[model samples]
Target: MDPWLSMYDFTYHLAQEIAEKIHERNRYLRNGENPVKINLSVRTLLKRLEESIGQLRDSLLRSVSTRQITQLEGDRRQTLIDELLTKERQLQMSFKGDGTEPDVIRSSLMSGGGAGPSPYNPWVLEEPEETRGLGIGDLKQQQQRMIREQDAGLDALSNIIARQKQMGYDIGNELDEHNEIIDDLTNLVENTDTKVRNQTRHVKLVDKKSGSCAMMVVIVLLLIAIVVVAVWPSN
Candidate 1:
């Protein structure tokens, strides 16, 4: 396979995975459930997806600028990138409804997270007995600070689910269009092949008939010579 095509396939698979994670995350958010696990997964996957895309883009740029890439290959890769980016943006906008995703992230971070609530897990914050005495106002202030800090890393995770939904739709649409074209070409090739086979058979049949006629004519000429000799004066 072409390097560009290989890169495209990897990027596309990552994008698809990210999109699915986002959808699952969205459902979690809507239900006011904890999206910490999903969010973390998405973050991990999203990082990989971004890296894959980055590599793919670099390859595409190099190949395309050198005119080594076909227009179709370029279009397929470029279209996927465009669709992924657009879907990301669309999710950011549409998923803005309840805005629960951010709140859940903030809560998870304050509670502590990562690998089942360890000291460094961003999703789980331990509220011990001593801290329980702190006034509500002070606690709010602290939580707000934590939210801000976590949001720094969480900036992209927010509304990611919405984007995945749109991304899936867009990607599917683009693929469908290309698939239809491919189907048409495949059908055309099949039809042409059938015609060629039929013509080949016809040519073979005609050759066989012509050979038989020639053999019959040869036999007839031999017989006529014999008959002429028999009917002519002995000489």
Candidate 2:
């Protein structure tokens, strides 16, 4: 297959594979329970898909010279692939079976410029331990800070879902409005076409009638002139 075709095919398959992995993870779970194992499995598959996407992109770029590829529609595809690869790298650093510290992961995220949770595995549910702090005031301050961070993360996820819903609704409404306008225009054009045909027929009828009348008038005048000459016995 052609390099561009292969790139497109790889992208399609990658998306399909991601979707399948997500579905598989969901199927293994029951109710609202969060399965850390399933989440990790899905993440691992996602990582592989990212790798495949990177390979596809690199292959495409290598096959097509930069001058030829720059103006190609694949420019957007390549950019998106780069972004996914970057996210995958960050995820690998944070969640890979290395048991990295959350603080280190957070620092890595800040420096690496990746979004979402800290590179540390958030799904790792650890039991709470007794805090032997110096004062109650300090403990309360820490609790409030943690609550604020959780709230911020929830708000961000909520906003993303809401925006996607709004975009879908907007597209649906635009398509309906466009179809309505097309229907109305189609009707108007048909009616106008019918009216034009009727006018053309009417004009042809009037021309035929006028021509018949002119011919009759000419014949009558000639007969009258012949009668006058016959009665006067003209030289």
Candidate 3:
């Protein structure tokens, strides 16, 4: 309901998607699938995350313009911003990886070692025949370049994955602390209610006893007046 909460949720989901894409790429690698496709998919996801970051910034601006935020809310928003920035930085790092991947793919092609044409995409165009004339030395050079770029991309992705894992653990810890606080508040409310009910009962018993004492005193005064009247001589 709160705008700050909404932004937090948005950021969380975006981070989750990024993490999933990374894991998906890893799976594709393990399965001996086309690395080019995996690279493309990851690049697309990074672009989407970039767009989402822009939207999140705009959303925060709108929220601030529409209402005055309290100190607590401001702190929360700052925390969310910090988290989003962290993710954004990771996305930028991944972007660095994406930037190198094309070079990696092209070099792989020049070295005659890329994954073959996709069977699922019959409409894809083939490379020019000019690439066939490249000498062995040139091919070796491209292969070396490809290896270097691939290594760089892998390092960036590994860092992003590790950071995402740490963020997840931090979120888990915050949730646990919130749950404990909720439990403590619940116990406090229950104890207060019990004490209130006991006080109410005690007040009612005291009122009843006071009423009985007053009635007994009134009865005794009436009897004393009656006895004095019966014992006195007529004037």
The best candidate by TM-score is 3
Q: Which stretches of candidate 1 lie over 4 Å from their true place?
A: 71-76, 91-235
Q: What CA RMSD would candidate 2 show?
A: 21.9
Off by over 4 Å in 2: 1-151
lDDT of 1 by residue, 1-235 (tens): 9776777677666655655566567556544577888778777876676677677777778877888878887888787676555444333332343433443533333333233523443222233554343554666677788899999758667668679989999999999999999999999999999999999999999999999999999999999999998999975
Poorest 10 consecutive residues of model 3 by lDDT?
A: 117-126
For model 2 the TM-score comes to 0.37
* C-alpha root-mean-square deviation, each candidate: 29.9, 21.9, 27.9
TM-score of 1: 0.36
Q: For model 2, where is the 10-residue window of minimal lDDT?
A: 125-134
lDDT of each prediction vs. the true structure?
Answer: 0.65, 0.62, 0.63
The clash number for model 2 is 0
Q: What ordering of candidates by lDDT runs from best to worst?
A: 1, 3, 2
| Alpha-carbon lDDT of model 2 | 0.62
Task: Rank the candidate models, highest TM-score first.
Answer: 3, 2, 1
Model 2: pairs clashing at backbone N, Cα or C within 3 Å: none
